[model samples]
Target: MNTYQTLLVSTLFSSALLFSATSHAIELPQLQQRWAEIKYQQTGKQQESAYQALLTEASAARAEHANDANYLIWEGIIRSTYAGAVGGLSALSEVKAARKLFEQAIELDANALDGSAYTSLGSLYYQVPGWPVGFGSDKKAREYLLKGLAVNPNGIDANYFYGDFLLQQKDYQAAIAAFEKALAAPDRPGREQADLGRRQEIMQALSLAQQKAK
Candidate 1:
């Protein structure tokens, strides 16, 4: 992949794993857990294949719970992850589709999974290519990230992604603060595995940001 494409994949994967909520709704939580296992435990083609099959289950869940915000969000999340793993211009469609689902999930209930729609949409806005290539803007990313933070001020995903945005902007100190907040976030009962993985990322990013700060 080219420079931009590689960055896109990396950003999407990082952001994809950011929205692990407290787990709700029987099947939605199941999807969430399954995604975490596939994302954190599996890799390469195995991961891609797992996300592919999960999409089928995600589709069924979304169809079954059309009005459920969590379902829409999870489906969107899975789609985004799959696209990230696939990596390339061709996956842009999946990204767009995921954005739509998140929008719908927000319209139904932004607070469904701790304002995950805002975080998800915000991450996508800033990470994707801009204008003729894709839709990306730092301004929009900050807007949605702040909204997500407002909804869930102490959420792990919210702080972590905001830290990432700050890191990208070269706001090292603020990024450090946000990453620290993410680390201090309360433990998510059913999502311990994902939390472990994410906290590792947090520490790594935090270390880098910290080094850059000095």
Candidate 2:
């Protein structure tokens, strides 16, 4: 190849790489929106299908950005959501896969996405069964939740999930405090619907904890 032809080929290859990166950037926000929609889905079948699709997309994104903590976290979140939608023994397997993804994200950057991995992993530890069935552990759950809070004291998810763990531990007053903090958390741009749903969850849990205390 002559000098001019080699230069032209190199330019084209760089342009293609730029385009691919830009396309993935555009797709990431859409994936987040799809995840929000999946959260509010009313039926199990719909949730299962939506989450399955999201899983495929997120997995592809993770592959493209193998070292990106954010992509890995989203992949883990999608997988965990799919597991919840398909609850049963099989769900445990899915959660385990999600766990590994979250662990990898933490290994890369535990503070990525405002400590999202910690909150998700903490929730997994608490929600999954323990002993003969699964790898759940109250101790690990609290540890992760506290780490999440240390990084993001005012984060809505950090507060809410920590509060939830407290409620399970029967610490009603502490749970109420955490839920209140979650309710007072600042609204995130482009996340209005998710914030609303999370607020509802916080309120319900707060009410239940309050009732239990009485």
Clash pairs, candidate 1, are none
lDDT of 1 at 96: 92
| Per-prediction TM-score | 0.86, 0.87
Q: How does model 1 score by TM-score? A: 0.86
Q: List ranges where model 2 is wrong by over 4 Å.
A: 1-26
> In model 1, where is the ten-residue run with the lowest total lDDT?
17-26
lDDT tens digits by residue: candidate 1, 1-214: 8999999999988776774432222487788899999988999999999999999889888987899998998888899889889888977898899999999999999898899999988988877777887777899999999999999999999999999999999999999999999999999989998899889989999999999999
lDDT of each: 0.90, 0.90
